[model samples]
Target: MPYTLIKSSNPEDFVLVHRFLMQAIQRLRAAGIPLWEPEDVSVDALVKAYGTHSLYLVMDNEKTIGGVFVLEEDALFWPEIVTNDSFFFHKLVIGDDFITKGIGHRVLDALVELAKSHGKHWLRCDCHGDRPRLRNFYESFGFYFIDRKTVEGFDAARYEYPCL
Candidate 1:
């Protein structure tokens, strides 16, 4: 399946993205995956992030299947790496209907390409430290486990993929 990631500045897109995130949060909670909280994702917060981050809507041809945010710098999660040599991925939410269809893997591949196009050396992201399945998912995508850290009251497992 071909996925198109469009950098959207539209307010409607923000709402759609927020909806997708909240849906994923609910699914995760039901599955006992303590990842994202409702407060962690809101339309207002996403709107604020739009000014500083690249918010993308993942499209599967005509349908919007997911969304993600790309940040040039993520000092809060990765304070030790004080450099813009990487693209930080956040809020990668795929619709429930699209899960397990290899859409997430394809999205990661697209993100890695996007990072390489921007001359970034690596693509980085963090997930709940205790989610082994999620961590394994990233690891399966060629992302190496960096370290686990408690940042801003969230315990996160950082991972980085070489954009070579």
Candidate 2:
């Protein structure tokens, strides 16, 4: 199946984007992954809080199978204050059907490219430290573990990859 990556530019699409995110959270919970936000995170709130640029979706035939949120700093999962020069990410979910098909890597590359287009130097994210699969996955993308500790009382580690 073919796929397309689209930015959240229209309100109607973001509604689906919100549903996409809720389902992803549910899926991760089923897989025993630690998710910070409650699955009840409202679509209207997400759309209102994130505005336009922070949301993204990966679609195949208009069906959203994956989605992510990019933030400058202070994502819901990552509440600690990070210093300048890095674009941050949180709440990334790829469906079971989308797994290992290079969708995650594609989105990472796309985000890095998008950041580079804005002259950003780094792309940063936080993840559960003990999850070897998740940790190794980001490492393959050249994101190094910068701070391997619980931040803001959340058991997570910070990872960063140079974009420039």
What TM-score would every model get versus the actual structure? 0.92, 0.75
How does candidate 1 score on lDDT?
Answer: 0.85
Question: Stretches of candidate 2 above 4 Å error?
Answer: 1-5, 37-40, 44-53, 59-63, 75-84
Error of 2 at 50 (Å): 4.2
Candidate 1 Cα misplacement greater than 4 A, ranges: 49-53
lDDT of 1 by residue, 1-164 (tens): 66878887676887788888988888888987776667667877766754534888888898888999998888788777887789998889998877765778999988988899899999999998988888999999999999999988888999999997
TM-score winner: 1
Highest lDDT scorer: 1
Point out the worst 10-residue segment of candidate 1 by lDDT. 44-53
How many times do residue backbones clash in model 1? 0
The sequence of per-residue lDDT tens digits that candidate 2 reaches over residues 45-83 is: 675666567887776676777777777876554556566
TM-score of candidate 2 to 2 decimals: 0.75
